[model samples]
Target: MKHFGGNDRDDDVRLKLVETLYNQPTSLMMAVLTGAMGGITAAIATQNPVITAVGVALALTGIVRFVLYYRMHRNALDHDARKLERIFEAGAYAFAGLCGLLAALTIYLHPPGAIQVLTVSLSLVYGVGISARNAARPLIATGQLLLVCLPIAIAGLLAQDIVYAILSALLVLVFAAVVSVTLNLFRILRDQITAAEVSARMADNMRRLARTDVVTGLLNRAGLNHDLVELLMALPEERMLAMFWLDLDKFKEVNDTLGHPVGDRVLAEVAARLRAQAPDKAAVARFGGDEFIVVAEVGDRFESERLARAIAEDISRSIRIDQRRIDIATSMGVALLPNDGHDIDTLMQSADLALYHAKVGGRNQVCFFDTAMTRDLVRRKEIEVELRSAIQRDELSIFFQPIVDLETGRIRSFEALVRWFHPEKGELRPDEFIPVAEETGAIITLGNWITAQAAKACAQWPEDVTLAVNLSPMQLRAPGAALGILTALRDAGLAPHRLELEVTESLFLDDSADTVRFIDELSAEGVRFALDDFGTGYSSLHYVNKYPFKKIKVDRSFVSGPNAGRKSDAIIRAVAGMGSTLDMDIVAEGLETIEQVQAVKAAGCTLGQGYYFSRAVPDYLAAMLLAQERERDEKARRA
Candidate 1:
């Protein structure tokens, strides 16, 4: 077996193999010193004028070659491949051989007294230089040793001098032993180099994997940011960058209904389409999930908008996967550099904001970010940034709205609404920043904080009046959703039966199995479940049948607006009847007017919550309101 069993054919390994052999600087330096020494030794050992003349000429030739090689090395680029290494090795070994031949001739032509000692000394010194400098590459050391010491050993053997023959035999043995030892050294160096190469390849693979999106073979968010920075650095002064943030509309519904396999195929198809349509200079990156970014340098704002529109038009085409036809549409947002903001982060944010507007205002189109949108986004970001700190600093508080039992005119429960006091912006309402918090993933932290705080508040409330808190879809999707509530209830000493966790019908459009399982697990713990904003989502009845909810809160939209087919009161009555059949209580939302209140009560609605009872009140005010209502009831009983 080949002892060194790696790919010796690798150019990097091959180049490393010859490093010591063609060390130009070392080779030239040694050649100059050895050439001068050889000439001087020849002159001193032999008075023969012919040998002296030839030695000087040999020294001059070696100096000239050294000068030439030095200039060549100086002119070469740092990355110049070692293509001439073998040729340079040949020249170096040939010059060393010539110097050795000159010295060998001197030994042959020497005058009698002390000359033999001087000549042998010259050969031994050269052999030492070879082993010392070139031993790292065994072949280089072997070549230099044979050239410098072999000729002298052969000359001594031919002289038939007993002492010279004994020394010559010893020199030959020493040369052979060094070649073997340094060859082992070369093998070690080669093995180390091969191991380094393997490590380098592994690092490169890891870097590529980090930058790539596994699903679509596109640059992920990190890679996109890196490429964007590189592109900006390479861009011309007059050119501006445009970022197009593209989101596949209704993608969540596709994942929910058709399944992730089809959703994945759709995402892949979208990437393929974008790759085909993107400009040569544009970079297309998958920003995870159904989002993608296409960035390019634009000559003007019109070109930026034009590119965005073209991309939207192409991606909106119908796609078919496994015989399931899907009509897909994309919403795109465009932001121009310098005009939007010069940095990659600001530009991407602007593009994302514009994409949001396009999606919300009837998707399948492109929207360029206007100045107004920038201001609006800036405000939203400010709120989102502060909202993170607000939750941590205990600046968020829960305000409860009374859900009244309309028949008895008594408050059955109080629903908790999170309110934030922005130190600079005054009291900010939930509608302004709740969605932002959800989008930024701050909701997870805020949700936990809300649950903990609300649990504590429930501990302080009357036992019969349960504390109801709205849950974001993110909260319910967590695996520990039920566990978190159970833990909080246990910590606060509140009975699970009195705590109502409210969720909207939109939860039904999510991963249905997980959602139902979450609700079931929590309901099993005696926590009451309410389907809030019931008719605002598709398939409310489907979700109602799937989960055991104790109450359904009618969405104010259908209750407040006149029914397209009949009076709004009729829809309310129908929902109330359905709730009755399910043994669930029905509460009408957005009952601001006394007439709307009377209408829902007359329609058989058992519970109601809206401005008609009171806008959501702070915890202290809610306590007072409940107290007043109790006192009034007692006075009525006495009367």
Candidate 2:
């Protein structure tokens, strides 16, 4: 018989085959009953003492085989598969030999009689049974077949009668045919088992892939949910689980300054650091881009807090990738089970809310969940919802703040600022609702309305005085923003040159091609641009040289703050000198007193905008101011 190649999988299949033989004992029972019946019947027919003794011996042997098989089955785990198979093979051979001896004796003692026919028939029955029953182990089946049938065939040939000689030849052919059949059955069984094992292995691999994060090799969101549920179910009363939600601070800057490939490397390194720093037996998972979650059991709130801070400190360390040192920090939010939340959804929500507070408070720190944070979040959400409908409800209005020419003391332009009149909340400033608008995508609609309104108001003023409207970075990146601005200008009958769009330095952080194209296209159309809050962000000079900026608005921090000093004066003078060389207007923002105004004018600023000149006023008041200025200029011209 052919055997399988002896690999581990093949060995497993072989063991299963051997186990099948022992598991089904119906064939073994039948073999024993047949042997006893045949032995008793032959003994009565022969009436010989030796034949009677052989009959008793055959019955005893069958009983012994049954008892041994039962014992092996009972203690199967105590024996190796190969050892058990060897013992089975030995018992089978012994039983078959006894049957063969009985058949041979009967044929040799009788002369073509009923007694001879009965014993030989029993031997043939046993041979057929072995072939079918022991097909899983074909070698054992073949050996049993030959041992039980060959002796009968020889005894028939020794009778020397032509009929008996023909029977012997037929028995030899049957043995060959049965052996061939058993071998084919073994091959078929083995192939089926091998295919099942392969399929099972493939399914397991697919399951693992589904749960794993491809880049970081950590559990993904779905896997985290699964483990969290199991942990909650098995949680002990004395133990509490802490869920630490971590977000990499300013991670988008890494991807924007570098590329996604380098960003991915940074994320992978962060994952490694988190895994190494996490408490033992903690479940770490990647919750999505630049976010991760760690869950572990701790004794008390202090331990949970300590662990969260430790993880944050470890992750704050600098990471080196591809010969570049990248300094990164993490903000973590901790939520405890049975204290902060009782279920997965509530715990996750609490952790996320805490994370928001951590980022707001400052990065590289840990924040625990509290009820106050939830109230603040709910209030912010309400403000966002109300701000969406403020414009349609006539609750939104634009205010104008004058930007004065320092040398002439004449208003050069008025920057349009938005204000909201909430019916229930009395009145709300831009800072209260604008951030919510930006987050909820309401800024796009609000910004467009502001543009149209400001343009119309500016058209009513003297053409020499332009309108300055601040643009959100989100508004600039929005598609068709340039077209929308042009549409507003065309509708309001305002010339493009009389509209100045002020953008912050943060706009250039990502180096977006679309933003550059937007600026370039608008500049070509004669619209003006100013770099607002210039010194507060990254690398202002690079952007000043790259874009066609008509003005540079020095951030208020450098003009009038408690920290303002000689260093501030130096920075202002340097920027003013640069603006002069570039032929761009330099505006000093946040001027509150005459001294501050004079200091900025002496520092080389061409323009100043702040409360010292005028606070933001409504359109009617601004138009009146512009009309009065025009009257004054007319008198001066006449003089």
Candidate 3:
């Protein structure tokens, strides 16, 4: 997994090839002897310095043969045997051909009697030797040998002009063969170079795939570790690296709602955005799933915080998937190296703790590692671990929160919420354990419990009142979830119209077409759809116009105070007006103050729910509250 600094083995192979090119011997030893005789013959006839120099050069170059042969025994016996054998054979054949030509040229120059006989005899000997050495292709070797020896032999016999005949034939044959073989050698070398290049490219590609993630095309875990370790060691001592561990908030909702294919695409889109937004000094990696880690260089904790916030905000804005716009958010944990902790394990733990803190602080936020966060993370981890057994022990329960009818100031429906009665922690709110349940895939079982419990409570309600149950996006994605609801309603003897399901916009994100289709199917069967946290999401007016929803609940974010931000007020009014025009119900949630209630009522909303009505209570207490409202309404009518 570590980055390679130098590859000596591959380099050594190339160096060895260079050495082989400069030092290989020939099999044509007789040709070398013939070359020496030609030098002496040329010395007598062509006293011209150039001719004598060429003859002498051929004789002296024969020393290259002795040097190469001396080293041949030391080479590896098995390694590249054919390649090395071919090199030696090629050199030997070329040497024999050169010697035959020099002999012919020396005779052609017309040397004296002794020189003439010696030159003609040497030409014949070289020609015969070349033919013998090239036994595998004697026709080519014999033809070249005759081309050099025939004219020299004829002239030597006819006029005894050995130097003239030998020089003419040898010069012609040697130059011609040299040009032809040189061209062939050039082509062979080019082919070998091209093949080596192809091999190098293939190796590079294999290394790339091994160290990269196919989905994000970023460094995989192994690559990340190598890169981080290298960066840590190379960084300036005065500066430090900051790591941000980011987990996409509620990413499972996207998967459960839209399926894994859509989820995969979303993750890719997120990775692209991260790379684009990441600082020049940062490295981003998709650790796995919807979790990513970014390592950056910063001047101080504040600078790190600034970068984390920017990243979180940019990612949270919006992502369109399947032609539907999704509101995406990420919770990030920031850990500074050498400050939070130096070692990878400690740094990772602190960053993870910070991430857990961000999630607990209400996702879509950034939290830096601190002593307090570690304690909270440990406690939260313990709680998450314990939640696994809560369902098995029958410790999970549904608590009812009153949904009031605004016009009559009476409780019309009891909305079911979840709570965990831990053996050690006493009572735990949904916020504390709902996330844990969702993470562990325990929401499916917990959701069934909520649905069944709410249906049973509805059975105990007055025939006019309805029971509202919250459904997780994950639960809604479950196979046969709608059927499960139907079964619970039938078993509890609750009317279909009297059972209302409060689902967040995330519900639309799953099996969206099928989910929307299922919603339509169930609505046709008298089930009502309440869009919860309306203003907090990408509330497409098209969705309201398209789906058969009965209610649009303004999120608490928009209706929390009398002096709510203009944006919040505008969104609430727009939603309420849109719902009214569509003949859908509008419920304003989190109306703790009378002024907030009045604001919602003025906006044409008909229902409200918050601490003003009552915090979530036991189903029996919720029923009593509903009954008390009825009595109070009766008393008001008498007054």
Candidate 4:
């Protein structure tokens, strides 16, 4: 048994064996060699049977211990052969114990002779055996050398023979020094080998990271560019090629509604789907932020379009993330090579232009680039530039539409809608420039201006009248936007209760938590919120209940015609009923006819706003209507 760390039972057995052979190498070696010399000398002198017997036993013991240690050292070197290591460990301790016991018995029998040489030799052999089993190579080598010299020194000491002891000690010292030097050299070489392996592993890891996208695990742009360049070079000059730029229809909505963590998981699933269904010849890359570019090789331009359509449909199929099934629809734009251009830049430009057209034409569709698409692209670019200048010049106006109370038949409040007064294009509706403004991040500035202007107008209205301002989804994310409205109201000397900010269900998309928090913050400042265009989005009722909304404006699509859609009518009735129960205000929009107005009023909607009262009028006309309403109410009260 051998002790490791600090176990007593195993240590006692090992210590007892080591104690028996302490410094016994010299005695053992000399006992073997000098005993042979003694027997030879006795053959020359008087022959003695006892002298021959002692000589043979000493020589045999030294040879046996040497053979045992050598075999154990070889077994320790074979790492794959673990059974050999265990066997060697057992055999080594057994040999050491037997050698120690033999030495003790020999020393007891031959007390007057040079018996200490046998005892010291057994101790040294036991030390080497124990050291080898524990993987102490340097110690094992040192112990082996000590064992060889201990026998020679002990023999000379007992005989008082100085010349024999000196020669035996010299021989042992040379053998031990050689073994120690060899073991040290081997260890240095082993360390160098281990370091080389680690360096190779690190290099492989770095290379893998370079080629893979961190978010989607798809090939990154760099990897895609390299692969595409190679493919282009290999293809025939006449071979048709195209790049399909795929953008998720409403990826921003996904990121906003569910958390971004869920968004990332959806992107990962999307990457997997693309890889599984992508054309064999096509190479896919994430490009950046919910956009993917696939380079495909085809036989003709039509084939490329067909392939792009197929890819779009494949992506539109359902995907499950975190146990929730999500429908992923993509709008893809294909730009054909040779027809578009051979260069990646030209191909990308055309594809992007087509992608814009797809979004404009209504999302979840595929479009191919042509000369006609260029006009729309150039026009859009012109609009984008003009929009930036328009913001700086303040070429915008607010059109206030009245939200009339059904019971009073009087305007209770007005919703402020934005109108872009383009220098050359005249008055432009939000549909013309809203998307462009949002893309340019100009909506933040435009939205703040609208909030401030509406709040300022609130002070001029009658004490009982309130001013309602529409909020874009972009404005909700603007820092201090809610505070800006409160500040404007305070500066204008208007009551907070008389100011309402209208936000659509789209505001809750992707960023519901932030929207909820912002609503809570502003609601604390006594500003009220109205959910605009309700029932047109997913779970608007649930959000209305969760949020602090003062009013729910039922979507106009429900009130578009008399009994137009049964589901829409039912939805309007349910929302009005629920709002009444929750003590919330319900407004019906798009009431163009008396029947639609009467239907909504019968449905229990207290507020109605649309062309029935009037379209959004100029400020002067609106003020006249307000004055008229007040005069009529005063006359009725007197009567």
For residues 1-639, write the lDDT of model 1, one tens digit per residue.
121223475766665555544465875577567666767676766767766775676677667767756765665344333544545556557666765666566566655536556545655666556555655455556677788787778777787888778878988788778767767666777778778878888998998899999989989988897888899998899999988898888788788889998899889999998888787877889997789999898899988767777778778888899898888888888998989887888888888888877865778888888887757676787787798898767688888889999998888899888998877788898898988888766787788778777788767777778888889998877658778888988998999999898887677775577777887787888989898887765745777777788898888886676652256667788989998888999998888888878888888889989988989888888888888988998899999
The prediction achieving the highest lDDT against the true structure is: 2
TM-score of each: 0.71, 0.63, 0.43, 0.45
Model 4 misplacement above 4 A:
1-374, 561-567
Cα-based lDDT for every prediction: 0.77, 0.87, 0.72, 0.69
When 3 and 4 are scored with lDDT, the better candidate is: 3
Error of 1 at 228 (Å): 2.0
Instruction: Sort the predicted structures by TM-score, highest score first.
Output: 1, 2, 4, 3
lDDT of 2 at 465: 92
**How many clashes in each structure?**
0, 0, 24, 17
Residue by residue across 496-570, what tens digits does model 4's lDDT show?
888888887777668567777788888888888888888776654567767888898888878995556777777
Better of 1 and 3 by TM-score: 1
Each prediction's RMSD over C-alphas, in Å, is 8.3, 11.7, 16.8, 18.3
Better of 3 and 4 by TM-score: 4
Worst 10-residue stretch by lDDT in candidate 3? 1-10
Model number with the top TM-score = 1
